[model samples]
Target: MTQAVTVRRDGDTFQARLFWWHAARLLDPGSPIIRVGFENGPKSFDDIWVEYDPKRSAQDQYGAPLRREHVQCKWHVSPDTYGYSHLIDPEFINANTRSLLQRARDAQLAYAPDGIGVRFKLLTNWRLDRADPLRQMIGTRSGAIRLERLYGSATDNSKAGAVRKAWRDHLGLDEEELRVLARTLAFGEATDTLDGLRDNLDVLFAYVGLRRIPRNESAFPYDDVVFQWMAQDRLEFDRKSFPAICDRDGLLGQGEGRRHVYGVKSFEHPIDRLEERCHQVLDLIPAFDERYIRSEADWGDALYPALRAFLLSAARDQSKLRLALDAHATLAFAAGSVLNIKSGRHVELEQRTTGERIWAADDFPPDVNWASLEAEVVELDPQRPDLAIAVSLTHDIAPDVRRYLSATVPTVGRLLMLTPSTGPGAQSVACGRHAFELAEAATRMVREARGSSPVAAVHLFVAAPNGFTFFLGQRQPVLGPVRLYEFDFEGGRDRSYTPSLTLPISTRTGDPV
Candidate 1:
């Protein structure tokens, strides 16, 4: 929950720049090489370090530029080295999902000059059932408007109409049915729940992305995201191949000679659940028969982009160079072309380390005494306001967490949390040994609402081989030999071994100290 940095109007467009935990590429290599983690919390935008040419003065392709713009790195973990667990708020996740999908749409043609855009708004997600004004404020339309005023896009109404129309035609649904679907879409709910087709569902038609394709290469804007959806699932035609849809149902998997099989379930491994569900539902759709067997995607492979961002962030903060190795990112960099910009030279990048690409490898900040960070436990909730009054020690909260927590409580501004690294091959000490109240709460809600195993998503958020993240509702109080709060998200465990122990290895190689 990040408050948009600020807003400034430029001509017809109200110009504003905001920072999000997006999986971006470094400017130097220009390719999908290194992950550019936009930092949040305590660290100032300029202060945030990006391990690049440092010498390469690249343009920050932000929407609107203003004097002294800002960025904050929210909670993060190293994705390359190890596996981790995180607690996220389900309500927030639901809202976040809608926002992400909508943003993905808005940014579809973000790179296109005067590109046509589509804005799917979140009119309401707030619970009037809650009594708090602050929470209400967070979930209000005014808040959404404020956010939009600062970050909204100028979507092309005509384009949205065309895409919506194309999708309906591809599905062979009449205008009346299309209107019904459109109404449900207006509510900002997951389209998967459009018809409550969750149980005993049948094969269906869908699109990998929007109906329109870029006329030229300049539309690098939508290419990355749209292609990603394609890579996630194979394309198929309905009787007539007039157009293509994402095919969320196993309809394609049931069709003979069809090349791609889209996903219906959320599980990450064995594809057993998906396999079973596809079989059960295929018969429901009269057109799809049992003989239709297309290749099933691993499904988990699609999350790699987001995982790259998490991995890079964790590596940088935790000081573990190895986690970088775990992500194909180094490979993306190593194999991708690099830009010298000056002489137009391309340099190949190689991985230098990876002492331990495991889940739970080492500790970070070997010098920072964990005992001091581990203090008495202090819990916070919507009911308690004076939790700040009981505060004694002021461990500096990392800049990123500070911003996110600031959105939670006023006290967050006053407290300094002892922070740690987000490297791989280790666990985040945040919720000591995993009974994270906030994380577990989110997991339960996700399981109940999604009717899918929370373990797959949870592992995706905390584990490697995929992108994983948790909400970690504003941190809780810490107590014991190792402060609970200190460990919460700190890369101490992973970074200590990687950073402190491996530094000498590089020095021994006689590389520049």
Candidate 2:
């Protein structure tokens, strides 16, 4: 008799959870995913398969008109790392068998014979070795290989060249053949824990009309259903059949309309399911370090222009938008400016305070006495041309602002500290309406201060909720020549304020004021 196999339940469960994450998208008619499969694809990298509709702007991988992503999930209890040289090791390829590279090539020929539209992803909890040349060859945003790095000059003798040559020789392929394979391969770090994946699923469930797993309940309804399907050898889901399965499993709910979620990521921490949940994603992270802008011109040349273009295009179809911002205070404000009150669009901001809440200006009735700003003006050098305004709604940021100004910008002659009348704390702004009202009052106060002095420019430093910051940005036009600043929350550099975007972009030339 054959020995019974001991299954790694942790790995199995992780794969199953990942399957549901992609499979649930079928419930949304607007989603680009047309089909999802469990344990049913090419043998090499086939934990799951997701086919996307080519018509939609789907999948970060660009070349293919019709895209199908093949994913292999490798989950381990302990963290580990791999480097470029490990690709030919026994870990990736057994001695007498086809290597991972070979299998990828075979899968490409079988699915996309023309060498286009196919992506193979190795999704693991493992990290890439920081010291390896492979780290530099990978695109941070897309998870795809950086082709330019892989295809260096003919006389190249760098470590990257060695990696490329090794991979090519191991695969028994020519330069052109290696390039084709490189384009199709992606290595991605799985950032979610099992609990985190569940939380993410709950959010997706709410959006796609599935019954959410109760917080207090111990039962894993989605997991149980997936296991039962696996036992029954039911491995595939398409747009038509997935709904029937949902109905049979008593998982159906009143579905929401196609949500147009946009993610503006300008920081290190990533938003969960940003690419999957968002209709459009503005990846502005490349222009920033933890504390400062990489290049000052990035605001005008890259960040603002990209944001403006995306919002303008999205506004053409969507009357209402949902924004997920993992960004700086300055960009958050700039986003609000693009979709200002005059734009005739309703925007709901994903506000992650004590918990997640969708905040919109029209969600509640405005109260005249909800919140008020108490302003204090301090005199600096009278000869200086700039005035600094520190708006501390969440906490008192005046000390930090003062320190930053003293050490850096000597051009500021005055400092204006604005705090909520109720004193600075998290609940300073009562609701969305209160935030709008407070923003308006804050803008009015700035105009008054500017009028009293011959200040050439107003420097703004804000410590508040994203919704409030956005609302403040919407009112930017009336406040002349305003420069926004961002705090180094991550403490990557000196924990201080750094200048970011300047408002009132020139209309004709499309440049920052």
User: Which candidate tops TM-score?
Assistant: 2
The stretch of ten residues in a row with the least summed lDDT in candidate 1 is: 497-506
Task: State the local distance difference test value for candidate 2.
Answer: 0.78
For model 1, what is the error of residue 430's alpha carbon versus the real structure, in angstroms, after optimal superposition?
Answer: 15
What digit string (tens of lDDT, one per residue) describes model 2 on residues 430-500? 77778878888888888877776677888999999998999988887777778988777745456777677
Q: Write the per-residue lDDT of candidate 1 for residues 1-513, one digit (tens) a residue.
A: 122222111100100011101111211122211222222212122112222222322211112211111221121111121100010122322343332223322232232123211122221112222332212212121111122221122332443344444544444555544333222111111111111221111111111112232234323222233233335552211212212222332113322221122121111111011221121111111111111112111112223233333333332343322211212211122111111112122111111111111111122223332222222222333333222211111223334333434453443212222222332222333222121222333334333422321211110111211111111211111110101121122231322111000000111232110
What's each prediction's TM-score?
0.18, 0.72
lDDT (Cα atoms) of all candidates against the true structure:
0.21, 0.78
Query: For candidate 2, what is the TM-score?
Result: 0.72
lDDT for 16 in candidate 1 is 9
Q: Which residue pairs come into collision in candidate 2? A: none
